[model samples]
Target: MKRKILAAVFLTVTATSAFTGTDLILAAEKTEETAVQKPDMEGIDTENTKIGISIYQFEDTFMTLYRTELVRYLTEELGFKEENILIEDGKNDQDRQTEQVEGFIEDQADVMILNLVHASAAPQITELCSEEGIPVVYINRQPDSLEMERWEQEGIQAAYIGADARQSGIFQGEEIAVTENQGDINGDGEVSYIMIQGEPENIDTQYRTAYSVKALEEAGVETRELLAQTGDWSQSQGQKIMEEALDEFGNDIEVVFCNNDAMALGALEAIREADRTVGEDIYLTGVDALEEAVQSVVDGEFTGTVFNDYFSQSYGAAELAVKFLKGEETEPVTLIDYIKVTQENAEEILELVNS
Candidate 1:
């Protein structure tokens, strides 16, 4: 993992109004005398607010689905003007995301929703938005420790909305352990697992891998980290990494736990090249219950996956942005729940995704 450096001198503000939510913590800075307070809006006009949605990248199919759903809901359901919503793809580049954020600030966007590439990079953006009095909402990623400290100091009206990444990992790990223990399709009583991680600095990868390992340990499964490599959420990178894992571990691998479905597909190709049947010779699991992954489950090529409700996360961010623009009180953090998808529930999961 790459080491991230924190920024210095974030904009500081003080909160005068009291709020409560598990998703965020509110604190006031001593220097500021007066702070703007917004009332929670159960009903208000949301006709002309401009929102900017900045994503880390658009490379993965699952992310594309998320983006599509967000745009659809914002336009069709929320009645946000098509031109009012700005969508920027960072292409997985931190520098690009920074530039895009600065541009959004210059455009004077009503609210900015971010899925940051690096947690530390948030302080600068947050500081800028704070100075401009624009609320920033984070989705799918949380601010790093330093950023969180600065957030409280700045009295930033922000929310961290996304699935519990560590819990998602634990769910994936538990499913794998249970299946292996039961020897449902015949197992050797021992499981050797490989993890295809996401971006190196991504919080999701860290938490998910940690909890997944803990779950496996608790289950008494002899798990080995056969290959731990950064996929960077690129299918090409996933394919390359899985190819190397295949060359090294080959048939001894009992389970392959991928961070997302695209990489899971890539790993599937590598398994095919080795002439081993997936879900038979070796089971597979992934996060981001993407279309292809769910389809693979229905076809018996993979075992299970975790579903982070991207639609609800995006929708909640948009709703919060509208409220914030209207000077309404909003939580600093809002966490969305995740679901585990297995072959038994693949059809239902697919229906939800499609709907």
Candidate 2:
């Protein structure tokens, strides 16, 4: 088992690590005032305004929190009627989600907040909604950039509200790179990692899988992939993948990067079962800064996780829907910043998540 030698050096690097090659466009900062105040709905009929929300999967820990907050904000804060807001779970099936969206269209929903089951289906979904003149606010799962470009070029009434997946990936890599040995636990001159990703077709999975390694490389650390597998954002799948990776790679696996915390928690179980202690022999990083994951970081079980900022994201989505309803202009793309969570800030984040 190997441990980081200089904790101070690691802390310094973690604090100073910055995003490279892209300007941070934070919608949270832009909507700070609106997030607190209710959207002005002078002539808008709150009780009669029908809202349709379709989550990719209700089982997703992060989106579960997001949908809850989104509904709460729309009703309690924005004065919309609870009965008018209809939410459906897509069950991670694209065809099922398409049917649900069609139903929303048939019901003549005033606005739809969509967490797409397949982001690649954006064009089809957009066409269905646009033909009916239903404004859409897409949340969480981001569509392809080209689709967003079409939204702008054609002046479509759609907007995407989510954090940049690249930032989350960068944070994950920075967490491992800031380790005293840059996650080269066995002094092998390379960080050998197992990547536990979410759905393969999801943009989050793609960006996180690629940019995590990109961040390590940018930090001047050599990296080798011991194994990579999709957990489909399921904890059990994460555990099974980690277990198999451990069996094959053993001590050579210096780090495990999970696209989200549910998988990281599952991976942690696998690591413990193998009697391999994290932050000693191997380090782990994940995204979404889930409550349990944050507590794990505080307890020194995880290297770090990124705060997905569901509060800002959900609120932003709702705000955009309100904007569309009011015939106000909205940017086609809205981005929130993902915050890095480590021992230094884990307790604070845990409290935030709990609240």
Candidate 3:
């Protein structure tokens, strides 16, 4: 085992130490503050503190950016050494993730941040880490509420750091609900749309799919699902699904809701190839205001997207890991809110991402 004493006695006072579970749950207020640069954790011997990060897949556009930010924050911002950070790609396989985590524990990593291949595996992973006294920070894919409850009850050094998917879902739906015709293209008195979903088991997929429609209904827009299929969070899958749906539903498919920007981009390609014009005959929305997606919104090609705020999420996760390593208390769940990106503010969002 390796450790280092704090260079400044007060350096151990972490920002998150003052936050309670309830306070952290209301994360929107803390977003700007959390995203600001902080003192590097050089006082704590970052060179000796091993950090383990496991991503579901590097192929995911959002996760790729997320993990990149996470590593950059840990190393450049927080002063962790390159050799001390270990990242593994699960290749979107549960068994592969399990194996990598087991290896991390075997190597006695100081902390682990996981974007699980399967959120259902949280209980097992938490148990393994807790037994070894290694703190775990779960991100992106959220585990069930009951699993979080277990962590609180047991006082485990485990926390979940991510955005509330429902918020993102509501943003996705409201984007279309506020449209000139309220997404009721062709004056059919109903908004018939296609849902391009990610993984079926992902909570983000479930909420984004359900709440986007719920939001439309809440805004008095009658909605009918023309087609819904799992795109598996792939660009090709999204394009294929959209092409098939367009073939069957044709002009009746008024709006398309994709769970993330990658799928939306693919869906956009399919729509253009089908000779359908967005904002003229159809509308589209997605989450994760990726640079391209935000640009599309600015170009009036995409209806809108929900900004996932990887900067805050990744920074928050790294901050929590530092807190745990310092023996500080952390909220079992820390939720960062999502932001809606529309054509009006898409340029600003694109600037933010680039900056």
lDDT for 280 in candidate 3 is 94
Model 3 per-residue lDDT at 98: 92
lDDT of 1 by residue, 1-355 (tens): 0000000001111122112111111122221343322224446444656788888888657767777867776676666788888889988788999899888888878888888878767778787788888898887778876666566566777766666677788877876777745322345555677888887778888887788777877877656677788887666777788889888887777778788778888888888888878766787788888887888887888777876667656666766777677776666666665667777677766665665
Q: Candidate 1 regions off by >4 Å?
A: 1-47, 149-153, 180-189
Off by over 4 Å in 2: 1-35
Per-candidate local distance difference test:
0.70, 0.85, 0.84
lDDT tens string, model 3, 218-280? Answer: 999888988889999998999999999999989989999999989999999999999999999
lDDT score for residue 31 of model 2: 34
Q: Report clash pairs, candidate 1.
A: 23-333, 24-333, 39-328, 39-329, 159-332
What's model 2's lDDT at 328?
94
Model 1, TM vs. native: 0.83
For residues 204-289, write the lDDT of model 2, one tens digit per residue.
99999999999999999999998889999988999999999999988989999999999999999999999999899999999998
